[model samples]
Structure formats: structure tokens, C-alpha cells
Target: MFANALVSFEQMVSSYPGPLMLVTILCPDPHFKKRHHKRRVVQKPLVDSILKNLHPGGQVFLQSDVLEVALDMRNQFDSHFDVLEHITDIDPSVLCDNEGWLLINPMGVRTEREIHAEFEGAKVYRRMYQRRI
Candidate 1:
């Protein structure tokens, strides 16, 4: 794993000549403090680089327990990429009638953090966006 996504993005993309089919960012550190916000993983430059390397119709999956962080990711994708759809496999009632965010885990595989969050009874928001020329 790269220590810094922004710094390593160029090299990572160049190393793989073939178009990337999918990129997943799950439960990233929110860096809640305003002063540390810059350290957050999902930023414009990284998002732009991901879009640049992603193949057309390829999808990007993002999930976070923090609603603010999840919405920030959605805004980034909406601004830079064409959002094809939002994937969910959960009951509407469980989400408390919130239609703005995804309720289910799109990626079948769950990260350790996600599993723990669920055990703690935390709400996890997810979003899936497609890159289109």
C-alpha cells in the first residue's frame, strides 16, 4: 500500500498500463479536525488521478461510517465523473428513510473496520460511481 495516495498516484497509474477496472476506498480515516483535514485520503487530486487512470465504465467504490466523509466522497465523484448509479442491498426501513446515501455494502467483501463498525451499531454509508467519457 502507498503511504500517500497523492504522491504515489502518478507512479501507480503509470506502472499499470492497462486501464484500471475498479478502485475501492473503504472506511478511510476522516481526520475530523479542520487542521488535519488536508491529511484525509479522499481529495480532489487523488480523485482526479483515479478518474484519469480508470477505464471508461469502470467503477469506484467508497464507504465510510462518517456521513460527512461519505457525502464529501459523493460530491467529489459527482463533480469529476458521471454517476451511473448507486448500489444498495439493504432494506429501506433500516436506513431510516434516508434516500440520499447508499444503505448496503456494494463490495461483497467487508473490511475488518466495517465489520467492527456494524458490531458497534454504526451506520455505514456507501457510494459507487462510474467513469464515463
Candidate 2:
């Protein structure tokens, strides 16, 4: 996960050269104020960088509990990309079967932080978009 707010995402475009891949972006913490430039990561330029880096037919997966941040992300991607799926549209029965489905982690394990967040009753909102070919 790239933590730098001014990351040059375009530099990583070649990491995947094929179609139908996944790119996950975890936005900066939502509690940051507008004046805190050091912590904000979801700016317009960064979004553009991400779009440029993504391959055609690739999926960009974004997760955040902050409503405002989510809206901003949706707006930015909507203007230049196509949304392929929303978490709610998935079949409920397939959720439990998703364990170990991801390619990067053979075990497909959830991070300890995620488990703690779930137990803490935090709302986790997930959304996915595709790069327009």
C-alpha cells in the first residue's frame, strides 16, 4: 500500500500488463481536516494518476467508511471511468466462498485491523470501478 499522498501512481502502471486485474486503493483517513494537506490522498491529480495507471478492463477497488470521501471518489471516477459493480449487487451466497479467492495472498486472509474494525462496529463501504477502454 502506498502511503505517500503525492504518489506517482502512473509509474506503477506496468506492474500489470494484462486485462481483468484488480487495483485496490485505500484512501487516507477521513478524520483529516481540509487544511491537512499532508494526510489527504484522494485528490483530483491522484485520481488522474490512478486512472492513467490502470489497464483497460481493469477493476479499481476502493474502500472507505467516510461518506464524503466515498462520494468524492465516485464523482471523480464517474467523470472519467465506468463503474462495473457495487458491493450490494453481488450474490449474498458467494460472500463466504470468497475466502482465499484473491491472487496476491494464497490464503486470502483478512488483516487483523479489518477484523478489529468489524468487531468495533465500524461501517465498511466498498465500491468498484473499471477503466474505460
Candidate 3:
């Protein structure tokens, strides 16, 4: 069933029967306006909830066409979770460094928005993390 992820993510995580193996958040609204930035979806509370619900080795994949928003997502994960290095077969140049900021799309599969952005020559940032034991 559909649920408001922002409000129900924690509950869903808690009630889930088994460990969540993978979580992907793609193209979250940037909320560009300074006044609306606070309303962005990727925040400390949600990150915390994800961490708590994640299995020790579960993976979290996040991507955004907006560099600033991607960086914010990285910051949120860095603060709460031990960011993981890129494990894809893609070019190493696209992988995240010690700071966990990916310069390319590691998933290989592009979202519709991502494809459109790429067609317009937009830069997308991505990050991946694994829950530590």
C-alpha cells in the first residue's frame, strides 16, 4: 500500500518482518528556496530512522540532479551512517571518495528525470552507504 514516506518510514521500518536489503531515494525535491529548504525530505530524523531500521549490511542508494541537494544527502548519511564505497562495475572515476560524494550515477539505470537532465547536460550526484554491524 502507498504511504507517506516522510511520516511513515520509521513505522514501516519498525514493522517490517525482515531486514531491508536495499533502500533507494532518487531525485528528492530540492526545495531551492531558502525558506523552504527546511521542508526537504532528506534530513537528520529520516536518516536516523533509516539507520535504525537497516540491517547491518543493508545498502542505501541516494541520487539527485541538484548538486547541493546531493551534498546535503551525503552530509545526512555521513553524520548518521558509515558511508560505503562504490561497489558497482562502473568506472572508478564515478565512485565516491573518502567524503562519500559520487560524481557519477553508480546504479547504471537512469531514472526518467536523470535521463532528461543528462540530455540537457546536467550533473547528477550520487552516494551509497551500508549499515555497519
Candidate 4:
């Protein structure tokens, strides 16, 4: 694993030669202090890079145990409503509710932190977005 933001998300994403089909920003850094907010992983540069390099119909999966961070991430990605559709907004199955929050992780696989967080009675906020075709 990379150490201490040794490589930014933008740089890592750019290293790929082709557009990406899926991107997961899971259990991201939660800089709780207001002064440390600048160090947070979910920032504009990363978002721009993802949007530019992601293929049409590509999926972006985001999750965190911190509610504030999760909401911030959701707002950042959902801000680009023209290009990105929140899974709940566009899922054809009509399983998503109008409330905008998801009850569980959509990805079949679960990270250890996610599993443990839930087991400890903490909520894991999850959101999925798709690049519009």
C-alpha cells in the first residue's frame, strides 16, 4: 500500500492509459479538525481527474464510517449532476428511496473496516454514482 499520500489519487488515476470503468474511494482519510480539512482525500482535483478519465457508464463507489465525511463526499460528486447520476437516482430496479441515504453497501465485497465498523454498532455511509452515457 502507498504511504502517507505518497501518490495522490489524481496521479494514480492518471497513470492509467485508458478511461476507467470503476473507481472506489473507500474508508477515506477523515481529517476531523477544521484546520486539517485541506488534507482530506476527497477534494476537487481528484474529482476533476476522475470525471475526466472515467468512461461513460463508469461507476464511482465511496464509503466511510464518518457521517460528515460521507455527506461531504456525496455532495461533491453529486454536485456534478449532469455527468454523474447517484445510483439511487438512476437505478432501474426502483429499490432506492427518495431519502437519498442507502441502508447497505452495494458492492458485494466488504472491507475489514466496514465489517468491523458495522459490527461495533457504527453506521457506514455508502454512496455509488455512475457516469452518464
Best-fitting candidate, scored by TM-score: 4
Error of 1 at 11 (Å): 1.3
Per-residue lDDT for 1-133 in model 3, tens only?
6776788899888888988878889998899999998888887788778877778777888988898898888777767624443344233545565555676665778899889888999877777776665
lDDT of 1: 0.76
Tens-digit lDDT string for candidate 2 (27-53): 446745777744556677777766666
- Of 2 and 3, the candidate ahead on TM-score is 3
Q: Evaluate model 1: give its TM-score.
A: 0.83
**Whose lDDT is greatest here?**
4
- List the pairs of residues colliding in candidate 2: none
Cα TM-score per model = 0.83, 0.63, 0.81, 0.87
Best-to-worst ranking by lDDT:
4, 3, 1, 2
lDDT of 2 at 46: 74
TM-score (C-alpha) between model 4 and the true structure: 0.87
By TM-score, how accurate is candidate 2? 0.63
Which lDDT values do the candidates have, in the order given? 0.76, 0.54, 0.76, 0.83
lDDT of 4 by residue, 1-133 (tens): 4744424666776787877999888888889999998888888877888898899999999999998999889999989989998887787653444456676778889999898898999988888899999
In candidate 1, residue 132 scores what lDDT? 59
**Stronger candidate by TM-score (1 vs 2):** 1
Task: Between candidates 2 and 4, name the one with more favorable lDDT.
Answer: 4
